[model samples]
Target chain A: MSRKISYREAMRAAMHEALTNDPRVFLMGEDVGRYGGTYAFSKGFLDEFGPERIRDTPLSELGFVGAGIGAALGGLRPIVEVMTVNFSLLALDQIVNSAALYRHMSGGQFSVPLVIRMATGAGRQLAAQHSHSLEGWYAHIPGIKVLAPATIEDARGMLAPALADPDPVVIFEHAGLFNMEGELPDDWTVGIASAKVRRAGKDVAIITYGGSLPKTLAAAEILAADGVEAEVIDLRVLRPLDTATIAAAVAKCHRVVVVDEGWRSGSLAAEVMARIFENAFWELDAPVVRVCSEEVPIPYAKHLEDAALPQPEKIVAAVKGLFA
Target chain B: MTRKTPVNQKIEHRPPPPPAGPVPWDKDFALQLLLDMLRIRRLEEKAAELYGEGKIRGFLHLYIGEEAVAVGALHALAPEDNVVATYREHGHALVRGMPMQAIMAEMYGKQEGCARGHGGSMHLFDAATRLYGGNAIVGGGLPLATGLALAAKLQGETRLTACFFGDGAVAEGAFHESLNLAALWKLPVLFCCENNLYGMGTAIERAEAQTDLCVKAASYGMPTFAVDGMDIVDVHATMQKAVAKVRKSAGPVFVEFRTYRFRAHSMFDAELYRDKAEVAAWQKCGPLHTFTARLKAKDAKGGKAKLTEKEFLELDKRVQAEVAEAVAFAEAGSWEPVEDLLKDVHTPEGTVTAAPQASTKAGRAKSPAPRSGRRSSKPTSARGRR
Candidate 1:
């Protein structure tokens, strides 16, 4: 049995289930309670869960995020929501310095079981300040697990496991995907590791995640019309890049194209391509190619923003160039 | 051709003298407080010697002149409460019951250290004592302390979280943010500011627009206290009341202990910022000798001696012996092996049940999995690439 639901609904349902299931789990962030969520993800959560569980924090990212780390250390499962990745920079010191380094620095005496959720990507014309995908930067950290939920099922399932994790977990939800509608399987179960092969094919592997998944899949559909079958791999977990699945896809397709929303230089796509080269260089038929955002601050102009991002047309061109 | 610039006038710096009063504590308790101060003084003195000898390396911020703050405030808290301190936290760790041997071993980077040789002098952590960290960042521990109190409030725990930082941290954005958050949430946190006058070489007057730190905290709408940090009696009395209010009301409180550090900021700093006379003036009011003097002061009206000079020497001798034992333990402690360097980066079983797909790989690798979860497929060979 399956039902169609929006990504926002899926995420809200997951948080609701978590709150109902565990007494230790509480949500704290700016506008999480009275203002609902920044994206209205927690619209009625305040009334449903009460003020204590659905906490509305002051505009103190460093304070609340560090508090979340402390709360996790002091024995509470905290779901700290930063409105967007751009604003998370205010709390980056706490996230990178204290939350990520505590367990290792303490020699295993403490583990921060904290889940920090933030909106990412640039398609809402929010301009340079409010938009930008920095999930790739977070993926570079060693002490944290980074997740990007592109599908409704993943949005519905990733929260439970992230909260269950003993270390810090950062979840990046694409800002453009909140209203994206998809069918979620009734028994939607997902893990925090490994890449899931959304659409299996044998010609070439189209590896993408988060906001770029829809664009890459659309590009694959166009490739399919032209009789060039492309395997679509949704990298749900980004930190420990499911190399085995990636290598397997590389072995089968023998060609890979990475699509990312982050800028070209030092992007997660660079890392993905580097890993593919490291693990499956012998299996590859050609060099792995990538389609990333242009090197510029995301502009607010509609055409300029569209051009700055990784689109289906651009992904198709990159895949076609690979065959050429 | 260059123009001649006007010379700026230099300002004079002078610290206040120690408070004059009879010893408030009984002979035994006063001796105990003196003993605690001596233990820290002796331990860090040995640490300085060891640093000179190349045995203990890294930034060593001694609490030589600010001993009364840690000694007084820490003793006022319950054992169940949490403590968070700054880099100059050897005194805090000792007073909170972390074995001196383990602290010395940590400075030695030995395997027997509290942090297993991972964190040096700046990052001591003890889970049993509920000591959160030896946080090195200026304003880093404030938010952590606030969060710990938030957890306690939410979980209905009676324990309070006491966070200690230097005057320098008051200039940080994290300090203001943490204070506001703690006050807004009404969390039970005791913010202890050890105002040692200088952040590295910059004086509080030169760095902050408002030198009154308690006012900065008070602006956050929490009760604030300014106490004479050199007097252990004042620090302990103020902390007792502060802790009581926090535990009773489950709200935040701030205390500014007007203290000073006698030594250079770190091992490398030169005492060029302030005059030698200024240092001598603060030394005249040093917590150790001043408190000892008050204990030995003759009541002009003929009261009993608070603490005899003989008892003071006995406590000093005992503290010296303990410090010697700690140094010996550090010398005997071994180094952690290179092979186990990555052991505790993440929890050992972090990937066991969290990732259901990885279980198949674990099975093929013949590794025992910790949690039995829903399996995805019939044991696919991990080696099956093509």
Candidate 2:
């Protein structure tokens, strides 16, 4: 049985479960407790976990995130919320220099079992300071796992596994996906290793994840209506990118189109294309095409924002262009 | 340019010295502290010689001049307490009980090194010693120390966290943020600042507007103190008081030790940062010699903390031998297999389950009051390479 739930509710559910089950687990972030999270993801958490466990912090990303690493080392499971990916920039030194690199640099003696959650992407016109998706920057690092939960199931399920992993895990919850409704399966088990084939087809492979997954699926539907069966692959895990699944999808489709909200220059789509060139170039019937946001600060205007993002229409056009 | 290794061959042929300060009821205890400091100094001197030989690579931030700080302060800390240190931390690791052999082997990049030879000069870690790391990034360890303190407080462990950073780290945002959080939450953390007066090339006066570091710490509502870092007596006395205060209260305390680095910042340093007169001036108050002089003066006055010059030389010889053994142990250590590179990138541990959906629970997922500022657009997808 599948039940419909919002992305925010799914994330809240995950936190509640972790706190209730594990006495060692705690949540800390700016506006996470009495303020109920920057996105209302931890609403009523203060009353439940109290200030000790449901900690509300000052606007100090580096301090709190580094503290999260410390807490993990001290045998506590800490889920640190960074408010937004843009603000996570303040804590980048801790996350990249310390948390991500600690285990590897320490020659595996120390592992940071910390989970950091942040809102990423640009769709509601938060402007340059508040909006932007830099999960790719984190994904590029070797010591940590980067996750993007495109659906409600992922938003709810990814946290537990991330916290269980002895290394640091970064979860990027797209701001646009908070209100997104989805029917999560009763027994859906989301692993941190592989990608998921959201929609199956053989004509063209539409590879995307996170905020762009829904749009790519929508575009595939439009393509099907036009007599083109476009397959859709959601790359759930970004770090050890499930290249095998991606290759299998491309092998069947022979053509690939990647959609990402990040700008075109050196984007996640670029990595996907590079992998295809390395692993499945001979099987590719057409050159890979990428549907990415315009290389501009996400504008505040609705039309401009829509034009700048990877829209379903754009994904459809890119898919059609690959065939044309 | 062709300076000798400073091994001081004259100080290597005597007997063990008597106590220097208030001798604890346990005889030979003060000797242990002296031995610890000597071990650190000898190990670092050996490290410098190896650096010259090109055997130990990377930034060799030797903890030569600051041995007494670690020797005295670590003696006052419990094994359960958390320790966070900056890059110049060979002394801290040794005094905290990380085996000298492992630390030397780590510098050699041998698999038997403390971090299995993966972390070179700047990244030593000993989980058993509760030593979080030899964090190289300036001011990076402050927040981590704060968190460890918070966890200990919550767990009712009665343990405190000691954070060691250089004067250079005072300018970083992490330092300010950590100070504020540690004070506001009243977490049990001992912020140990080794103010060496310079950040690599920049002097303290040129780097900070307010030269008073304790003042900055006091602004965060924490009790702050400044001590003579070169005097092991002052470092020990100040740290004992600071740790007690933090353990008794529910908050943090800051201690600034005004110390000097006798050696260059790294082997690569050109010595253009400061003048020779300044180095020579600080060298006159070097911890070992001054403390030895103080002991000899006390002995002349018929005090309990008495030691002959010959005995001090003997202790130095023992420490030198220990350091040589550590170096040989490192040279004999093996390299890690190249195929194991992917291991420990993430914990090979089993996965965590997904968080449940909150909307179905009705009472769990209520939206809180909206943020005050103008709202931004929803976030975009992660762009650029995965």
Candidate 3:
């Protein structure tokens, strides 16, 4: 049986299942317990799991994140929540220097089975500090797996596999998608690699993930009405990018448009476009185009912030340009 | 909160303080500690020589004057307890049971090295002994130790995590945050601060407002102690008490082993910051000779038999031979193949398999439904497969 649930509830259910199933699993982050998580995703978990498992932490991102790595080393599964991608910068040293490099640098003697989850993207007028997507920055690292769960099933399914993985995994949940409702299957099983083609089309492949997935999908529907028939690919795994699926998409549709919420310059969209150019350039019907956030700090004003981010209209426009 | 004007006080260069208590005089135990210190001294001395000979490349931070800190404290902890150390950790790795041959080969960047030549001198890691890493980032290992302690606590294990860092790490925000977190959670962590007076070329006094490291740690409400890092007996004794308290789940304890580095911070350091006279003064009371002198003091006093001159010579001889054998092993060690350079980035199970070739079929091939009879017992699923 399948049940309809919000992405936030689906994530909460996943974590609850992990906590109940594994004694070694614990959740630690600022206000994860008492304040019921910054996004309220962990609401009521404190009372259910007790203080030991659902731990609230001070605003010490570097300390707790590093502690998560250490706990992983000491034989415990820890899910460290950094509130948002913006705040994760405070713990970047630990994440990059310790968590990402430990396994390879330690000559594979230690595997940090640590999971770090953070809300990403700018849509709620949070301005420069809280806004901006940096998942691409994390994806650039070699030793850690980067996951962006766009669907309700992915939100519910990704955490278990991530917790089960022996290396460090960073899961970025779109801040905007927390309240989005979708149906989750009773046996929703998903892997953390390869892009899933959300909508099939022959004209152009609209590749995107995370917060941009819905926008691209909406744009694809718009394109479909205009007889463009754009295929939509949700790149669930960012690092160790599923190039084969991407290449296949490119072969199926000669034209491509990459939609990303991160800034246009040196963005994940750029990397995806580059991969297509490298792997399937001969199959290209036209030069690939990208619809990304403008290269500026996401402004506070709603109109400007909306203008700065990639929208469905912008994605549709980019796909039209690719066809042109 | 009004900010106070910073005072520019002239710092005084001083020798390492004397031992707080009498040497725990047990012949075998004392000899074992002495031999451990000697092994580190010989191994590092040979490493420095190799660095000069162009055999060992990269930054080499020798634990010449701070041997007692690693020797004494590591000996105090049980074999099962975790150890996290900083980049200046050849001595800690040696004391933590990493083979000298592996460590030497790692310094030579050979396939047989502890980290399989991936990590050079500054990144010695051994999982068997739970020596996490030779973390190069200042104050980087502090939170890792805290997390390890948290894991042990969560698992209901009595094991303690002993972390070693230099005084320079005290200035980092990670140090303060980690200390507060460890103390707040009452995690079983033994923070052994090796205060060798400088963080690279920057002296502690120049970099820190509160030069007393133990005072900084004590602010977190944990039991903080200062010991003579050059005194092996004091270090071991202090560690014993600290380890016992942590094992009893009394929360974290901070021990500041006040020591000094006899060599430059790394091979690249010109050491233009400190006076040569200060170095000479610290070297006068170096852990090697001072402890040796104390051990041989019984002979001069005509007291009962303790560590004699002959015993010291024999131990030194054995350490020198071990160092020689380690060098030979490193010399014979082969280089890792360039083709395998990309390996170990992720565990084999977690590796991202190559995607299937793009199909021209009309519809996307749906992944087979997961076998419903048995739950997915494997922690990680195969990538690029249904």
Best by DockQ: 3
Off by over 4 Å in 3: B1-10, B16-22, B299-301, B350-386
Instruction: List, for all models, the DockQ compared with the true complex.
Output: 0.27, 0.25, 0.34
- Over B1-386, each residue of candidate 3 has an lDDT whose tens digit, in order, gives 02222445544568856443335667888888889999998999899999999999978888888999999999998887889998889999998999999999999999999999988889999877888889999999999999988887776677888999988888888999999999999999999999888888876767776787777888899988898888888888889988988877559999999898988888998888888889988888788787877776655446665677888889999999999999999999999999988787877764322211112123332231231112232232332232
> Model 2, retained fraction of real contacts?
0.43
TM-score of each: 0.93, 0.91, 0.93
C-alpha lDDT of residue A295 in model 3? 89
Give the poorly placed runs of model 1, Cα more than 4 Å off: B1-11, B299-303, B350-386
Q: What is the TM-score of chain B alone in each candidate?
A: 0.88, 0.83, 0.87
Expressed as tens digits, the lDDT of each residue in A1-324 for candidate 1 is 677889998888778766755667789999999999988888898998899889999888998999998888887778999999999999999999998888888877888889999999999898889888998999999898899999988887788778877889999999889999998765545788789998999999989999999998899999999999999999989987899998899999998999999998999999999889899999887888999999999999999999999999998888888889
How does model 3 do on interface RMSD, in angstroms? 12.0
- Lowest lDDT 10-residue stretch of candidate 1 chain A: A184-193
Between prediction 2 and prediction 3, the one with superior DockQ is 3
Q: Write the per-residue lDDT of candidate 1 for residues B58-165, one digit (tens) a residue.
A: 899899999999999998999989999999999999999999999999999999999998998999999889998999989999999998888888777788999999
| Order of the predicted models by lDDT, top scorer first | 1, 3, 2
Q: RMSD to native for every prediction?
A: 6.9, 8.6, 6.7
